[model samples]
Target: MNEEQLFKQISLVRQATLKQLESVTEAQADEQPEGFRNTIRWNIGHIYVVQNSLLAKFGGKPVATPSRYIELFAPGTKPADWEGDIPSLDELKQELEEQPLKLKEVLSGQLDDEAAQPFLSLPTVGEILNFTIYHEGVHTGTVKALKDKAAK
Candidate 1:
């Protein structure tokens, strides 16, 4: 997809993800629904860190995160096993709100620049941006499904 379309997708998904996350209380965020993968809280932090890391692969550093969170919530981890420094629900929400704008600024300025490098071996800048949107969709869907289950 073109950078403009890609950015629109990111903006849409990030906003929806934030709305879903905001619906849950901090207490609800503490526990994963049975047979579910992650608490909404974990997904929030994971989304933030993964996008940040992806940008870093292209030599654009994301805001620093505590090492403990990296160990606890990185991909392939399950919620039950997480034992890292969990940020407050509010902090996670704010990062979710802020990251897309940061991403947009970075991408808007560099999409055509020869200086922009591949992130994590992604063949194109488009691929890296797409992955970020896809990642948000995954967790946003996860959180929505879990919330539905909790409601029922």
Candidate 2:
């Protein structure tokens, strides 16, 4: 699929993911349910961070994510290891809501451009963006599962 179609799917997935967070309270978000490695809040932040890191950092585009977000949620980091001042679920939701629009702005007309350094096997910007979307969906599913388990 092309960039427009891929972005549309990204927006849809993001909306659904945010909808899933609407009922989750701050306390619920912080819960690391049994068998889970991270909290709902961590997953939410990770979702935001990973896409920006992959496309903006790896793809060499400008995406204005706070540096702290990457520090807190990047792959090896966890809520258990976070030191202080974690973003609330509402704050994360607002960023999540705006992410796709920002992404579209930065990446407009550049989908065919090749990545500066290919991530995994994704060689072009479009391919990396597609992989990023898939990554988001995976985390979104984990968010749903964690939210459900946390609510119990």
Every candidate's lDDT: 0.73, 0.87
lDDT of 1 by residue, 1-152 (tens): 67778788888888889888767888888777668767887887888877766666564444355566666567877667756456889987887788777777756755544324665567555577677788878888888887888788
Q: How close is candidate 1 to the true structure, as a TM-score?
A: 0.80
TM-score of each: 0.80, 0.96
lDDT for model 2: 0.87
- Model 2 C-alpha lDDT per residue in residues 60-120, reported as the tens digit of each score: 7777779999999999888888897889788999999999999999899998988888899
Q: In candidate 2, which residue pairs get closer than 3 Å at backbone N, Cα or C atoms, i.e. clash?
A: none
CA displacement after TM-score superposition, residue 37 of candidate 2 (Å):
0.4
Q: In model 1, what lDDT does residue 48 have?
A: 83
Q: Which stretches of candidate 1 lie over 4 Å from their true place?
A: 58-68, 112-121
